[model samples]
Target: MSRRLEFSPTVRQKIIERDQGCFFCRRLYHMEHALPGDLAPKDIMHVVARSHLGLGVEQNGVLGCRYHHSLLDNGNKGLHREMDSMLQDYMRELYPGWTPDSVTYHKWL
Candidate 1:
């Protein structure tokens, strides 16, 4: 079967500019493949996650490496929840009233 693929050049450029290129490792101008795999070059994970209310927008997303992406996906929820709590600590510091449950995503986004 044949499959069609789509990617947003505008979003890619924006992410490249915003992250100075690499997302997870924070490198610059890294090359990326269309999908994730060992053959895929080091690049950002521009997720359109169903759990994050993400609309493929640059702002409503995250940057991660392939390894980290896999870890985040298959890692234990307790660890993930801990990490989320730590992240929320920073978010609450900025927003003041942000709660842990407010931005928590059951799935990676």
Candidate 2:
């Protein structure tokens, strides 16, 4: 297996500022409830995973509150089997030019 990492500090901050909160939460809940986006870099997930050559950068990052983040990663183990697929679609809409190999292994830390 190869090494993978979360977003770097600077990129993480940029992501936090850009996202402002969990876009996933907003998308899922539709702002019905108050969701805290008080997340750290650890909460940032790669839209395209590093195993597939995703870089740890804002362009490939998405913030999520703990519950939603875990659900996205784990797919709620059958609760939502297509969370990752949904996220991929959303991220692609967000980044039209971001390809898995575009910045592969170039600026990870």
Candidate 3:
């Protein structure tokens, strides 16, 4: 069985700082499409699920608001591609030797 990782406070803080806010779902609502604001707390989500052997390291983590977290956990149809792209960019920026193929973001999806 695959194991899940618990983030240390330092790691969690780093992720929060890096992501700033939800990796997905940030947008301007037009006058005709205004919706209630959400302060949904961010969650560190696994790019490749633990069940599928994804690690619990920062490289595999994506910051997601609660709603998006559940969507990913439950395999609900959602905006995962955006999240994957963001994470890919982040990892590449922070870890110079890291390659896109080094992580498994698309296979699980």
Candidate 4:
């Protein structure tokens, strides 16, 4: 049995809709690019990494704008690493009980 690694469109759309914009803008108070007309989220980030066996459900996903998503994907190369690390703490808050074992599983399960 294989584990699903990517978020389905349905789940992705729901996340974008629920967030109503960048999750950081709405929740984390990051309004750097959130102007008066910004409403479309550019990416849905996994709280747990897909490579690390993260699932694609809403509880495990979040909406982010392009700039924020780039920061999330940037791994320890810049001072922005602190910014991304902060996001990890936020993810923990978002999914309080999430663990590798809880979020990862075979499709059959």
Candidate 5:
């Protein structure tokens, strides 16, 4: 059996409300599997990638649909940078300890 991340119902609701829907298109995502058997809760890609430098908090994350997530991962530099900046601002306000240097924004892309 595979282990699944179990987030508190309150946390999940907060995430949904924070994004106010989709992080990219700002629309309501129907909450489905990205593919056929993925168990993830289905969220948007972090503009500044959690693995790369994202803060690993709700503010650092976006609520993108699978399509936008793909576009971000496939090196869609332009949109990626734009979203990164937006998320960064939100993070700075949410996390006072967050420094700009903590994450490198690829604005040129």
Candidate 6:
């Protein structure tokens, strides 16, 4: 049996803070171009889907605007690569190389 995977609210907030804009198009609030005065909800997307055993943690999250989020969910190959590359870059920048496991998500869990 597969366990339900979930990210804590703190992790979701961290993802929003880290990925200030959409990973795909850099839109802060909406799609590539949001209408003036419009406010669209942002989505915390998984760089690797949960079905693929992706961890429900900050390292695996990216903030995406609604349109891009759907595009990712619907299997846009190009966007997948783009998001993966971005996540890898972020991981390197944030962690450099493997540190003690305790320094990673150990404390969070």
Candidate that scores best on lDDT: 4
Candidate of highest TM-score: 2
Q: How accurate is candidate 2 locally (lDDT)?
A: 0.65
Q: Model 5 over residues 63-99: C-alpha lDDT tens digits?
A: 6556657656764545556555666776677778765
After superposition, which runs of candidate 6 have C-alpha atoms over 4 Å from their true positions? 1-4, 27-39, 76-78, 98-109
Model 4: lDDT of residue 63? 80
Residue-wise lDDT of candidate 6 within 77-106, one digit each (tens)?
456566556656666677677222312233
Error of 3 at 83 (Å): 5.2
Please give the RMSD of candidate 3 to the true structure: 5.6
lDDT of 1 by residue, 1-109 (tens): 0111122577656655655523433432222422445324444442433344334444433455565555445544334544344434544555577553343343443
Candidate 2 similarity to native, TM-score: 0.65
TM-score of 5: 0.51
TM-score of each: 0.45, 0.65, 0.60, 0.62, 0.51, 0.63
lDDT of 3 at 53: 61
Residue 99 of candidate 3: its Cα lDDT?
59
**lDDT winner, 4 or 6:** 4
lDDT preference between candidates 2 and 6, better one: 2
Worst 10 residues of 6 by lDDT: 98-107
Residue pair clashes in candidate 6: none
Per residue, candidate 2 scores C-alpha lDDT tens digits across 1-109 of 2434467789888878877777666565433433445333237877776666777767778776766666556663563446666666666787896565664665543
CA deviation > 4 Å runs, candidate 5: 1-12, 27-44, 92-109
- Alpha carbon lDDT of each predicted model: 0.43, 0.65, 0.60, 0.66, 0.53, 0.61
